[model samples]
Target: MLYGAQYYRPPFPGRACWRRDLAHMKELGFNCVKHWAVWNWIEREPGCFDFSELDELVALSREYGLQVVINTVPEGAPYWTYEGNEEDLYRTADGQRVAYGGPANLPSGGWPGLCMDKPEFAALVAAFIEETARHFADEPAVIAIDVWNEPHLEPMYDYRSNMLCYCRHSRAAFRAWLKGKYPSLDALNRAWYRTYSSWEQVEPPPRFGTWADMLDWRRFWLDNLAGWLKLRAGAARRGAPGKVVQTHVAYSGILGNRIVGGLGNELGDEFLLAREVDWFGLSSFPKWLMGPDHAYRHLIHNEMVAEAAHGKLFYQVELQGGAGKPGLLGGEVPDAGDVKIWNWNTISAGGKGTVYWQYAPEPAGVESPGFGLTGFAGEDTPRSLAASECAGRLNLPELDAAVRVPAENAVYASRSSDLLTFASERREEMYAGSLSGVFRAAYERGIPVRFLHEDYIGELAEATVRFLYLPLPLVLSERETEHLVRFVERGGTLVSEACPGLYRPDGLLDQEGTALGRLFGLGHREIQGLPDWGMVTACCEDGTVFAGKWYRQLVNPGQDVRVLARFEDGEAAVTERLLGKGRAVWIGTYPSYYHEHGFELDGGGKRDGTRDLLTRFMSLGGYGIIEKVEVPECESSGISLAPVVRLHRLEGEYLLTVVNHLEREARVKVWFREEQAFAGGPGKCLELTVPARDGTCARWSSSRR
Candidate 1:
């Protein structure tokens, strides 16, 4: 695994530190550095390509034994390339074209505008790529090409202009896309619920509206961006054949917002984009959003990128490296603890490498004061030293020796979920709240859980997925529903919450009632809100009780289904059903809300119970004999918070990592299944007393002595 920071050339005032920066990062255990090939800077004039600066950087990095990842910024073309082609400037919904660094002396002597889907603009991009490839192809230090950066048009935060790049060029491209999808105008009209007589009449929606059209518009750009990436990757491969080519995703489903024009920070379907590139990385800054909730959401983001890689481990790019500038997008500097946990959280989620955003603060820029590994004076800042020390510990041989396996608990995420989740920002309120509460609950209980997008659902059997948890899947297709049923029927445990499979894959309401009733053997009736901050109460026959500020629901359970609990009004609150050799559990109310918001909303008991519920749901898988973990001595030890423990199966061995977030030392024990002792003669009662706010990771094999 690689551990390092992004190395940007220093501004002119401190240009001398460029070489020093590479040297500093090298000594800090960084193996790689990425340089943004700002197209405008590389090609100052039309057809006159200059490789001087790029060539120097590559050669210099090679001297430091640092691998280089070059970003081909076709998304930011030089002004000269747009000469006599200013009409190609990306046009927004309101006909406002983003004009930054215009005419004469370009802003900072660079332009950041290009219509990615345009043929003429694409040719220029190809030329730049080919030239870059020819120049750096033979450079041993240049190891990868970042095929594109951010992959969206400019005026990113200008919400006033509406969603992005609705220029005639993109609209024509989208029309062509519709032609390919619908084949005829009549079919297109039927799908979009429109009366268009020809494909030419179709256009990207003016604004976010109607799931049918919004789906089409989003799908178009998602595919468009991916298609454009494929071309760019091909160009990079042609330019530097066999070099590792990768790209990155920016949108955090929970933390990120839709860019202007409804084209989000990520494509509608990230897997599609991943399919077009060699590998995928994501931008993660826990500070960008707040709370430990961001930590779990960040985990999901990392998992999405990992899934997109199709077995290739993912990376985290642009990690928080400095204190954010004080403003809307900035925040206070992250502490060593936050940085350490952030890195581990992503890695534990299966990231192969991580690159901090920068090695030093910029001498000048919009974000100059915000992000840095060191201060502007080039002195090692507290954060940089902490990052370097952290890097030294991670760039180890053992990391390479271990192979990451899927966790026991897997959450299902699909494109339908994303489409519905991102449809309206308001609709997304439930998404993070639900998943975070569940993830946090599982974390506290030490149940190894991870997110698996629908694309990887077929691998459930091979991954040894014992339990499957779906948190509010609002949409599902027939195929997806069938897959879920088969999974449950094949002896896999299942758990889901409200609105699971209630909507069709196409974003329409599934009016036929229960689309997934056959598996869970249940269907939801009307969901009635409790008036006057009403607290929904649930009591299980097993003597467990939970109450929350949540919605009340009525449910219909089948013959084999057993109602475990009900609302105060006598509606089904939770139910369990047997399917084949397996069982599925359905949670009726928004319990996670009770878990996360309870502390503030006067539902602490519900919050604590939710954690037990996550563990109980998995225990319902009906294992006659199973593994168990116990905190044997915590009360006297002053360890208040439960430790989070996870096991990663590897080739002929497994790695168990435990993070103790508590303030006091605590002894914990793990009893293996089948009374098996730990490998090499360790007893069946595997016990350890972890230090406060510390972590313990050990490699183990199942081969007992």
Candidate 2:
């Protein structure tokens, strides 16, 4: 495990003091450090390359026994590069220059928002990468090369600049992409309903206007980013022949705009960006995730990142360490306990390497009082002590050999649904909102979820995934619809939301035939999007009433379907269709979304007992479908009480970890049913508890007794 921190800028306070900082890192049990190879800082002049500072830092790092991972900060293009290449800068649909620091920083020293569409920018980035890679290629101390910090035309997640890249390059590239997809302009017109005189006139729309153009545009950027990632990663591989190359995204595209900074799903939410890298990486802010607005999204995203990394885990490149800008929940700096829990939670949830944001906050930068393991003045803070303790704990052999926790339930997440959500006025609110709700419901119930992309729905036969939670599926291809049918036919129980597969992948209505309707036994009637709080009131078969938002699609059920819930108008809102060896329960509206959104202490964020639906699924021969550790009374004690538990199997023992998500203390009991080879976990059933905002781990084997 690499206990690491980011330190790219020259050196805080002075040249010689940085060595002392490295020594402090070594004393704290940190074995690695990631240094950003900032383009602007290095190349003061466009083509004039300088490596004096970086070379010294690398050499100094080796002296301190710290392995180095160099991040090529090409995204932060120097002011000089943009001065000569203004055409490379990203422009809005209205042809306005995009310039702003993320949400908090503002126009003060904001980024020029350079797009990869320009060859000049790409050339400069490639040169920087090649030089950096070659410089540290043979240095045994250089562990890996980061391709680029966060690759995208739109600024970081919270920029909210809405300043999309619609410059001449982007527009021409879009036309070229369309030309490749659709052979003739006439064919394009037939598909897009636009009588363009020529392909040249078919410019990219200012904003997402129609589903066709929108989906296509989103796909183009994804492909474009993927292509750029491939270039960057390949360059790094060439520079350092055998070293690991990586790049990361700020937020999981699934979380969308629920938080302040999440760049919407359409831009760069792709997990499978470039496959050449050894491991995938993503950022995680502990305090940012510990809230109603983002907690569930954070949970779901970990699973998503793990799955994206070839069904493995990822490196937490930027773990939050100190008091944040708004002071991380009322200016409260994270204590030793909070630091310990967050790091432990991350590792337990399949984070390979844990690196804090920085070694020390910058003395002169926009992000002053920044998140750092040590204080800006190099004075050791409580976070440093916590990091030291956590690092010591991770060095244990038990944690090193632990296997990843198994995901029993698969959350069937659809990108097409995300695209559909992107086209709504409520896109920001609805982005991954429904999916997060389902995941949250399952999470609170102690069920681990794997975010299986809709693209891979048909390939889940290798694993014993019992429950497939399909929330808010709007568009599906003919193949994807078949895949869902087959999964259900193979005995996987499915829980789906309001509208499932109403349109094809191309955003075209499946007018020819009703593939999804026939499979699920649901006949679409009409949809009501909005009319104030004219929210649909639903009554479950168990006499439970719940309120939900989103367009309510009235569905007439087939004979094989059973109405499990209905709307206030007595229309069948939720239904269950039994097909072959499998059963699918379709809830009319997004009750889980409402449950997550309208959380209250008395309501327990339970959303009218939506978890009862999960219980019902478990009751109908669903409980034993997958192997899981039985947590007795967790359902009764509730999410607040039931510490978030994860188990990782090892050579001879089970490494079990539990986390308390709430502020107050909570207790729980775990009883691992014995398998023939493993025997019952902990030798026997044991009861234990953790403090508020903390976590605990236990290692057990059959021979332990």
Whole-model lDDT per candidate: 0.66, 0.67
Per-candidate TM equals 0.89, 0.90
- lDDT per residue for candidate 2 within 1-705, as digits (tens), equals 778788765434357677888888898899988876767667778678788888888899999999999988765566766565666667766676665333232212325436778776777778889878988899999988988675555453433445366878878888888889998998888787888997778877666667777777766777777777888887888788888887776656666424322334336654656354776777766564445333344445565666666644376777777655554222446677677666766666776757887678645544566677687567888888888887887766777667675565767767677766665522644646666666665666666556678656756675456678777777767787777777788887787777777777777877543654756788877767857633556677778766666668777788889987877779887788888788878777766565444533355434545556643564221123224434333333233323467667778666677676556666655554443222443333545577766677776663445
How far is 316's C-alpha from truth in model 2 (Å)?
1.1
* Candidate that scores best on TM-score: 2
Superposed model 2: Cα runs more than 4 Å off? 11-13, 99-110, 154-161, 257-266, 274-276, 288-297, 327-332, 511-515, 599-606, 618-642, 673-688, 701-705
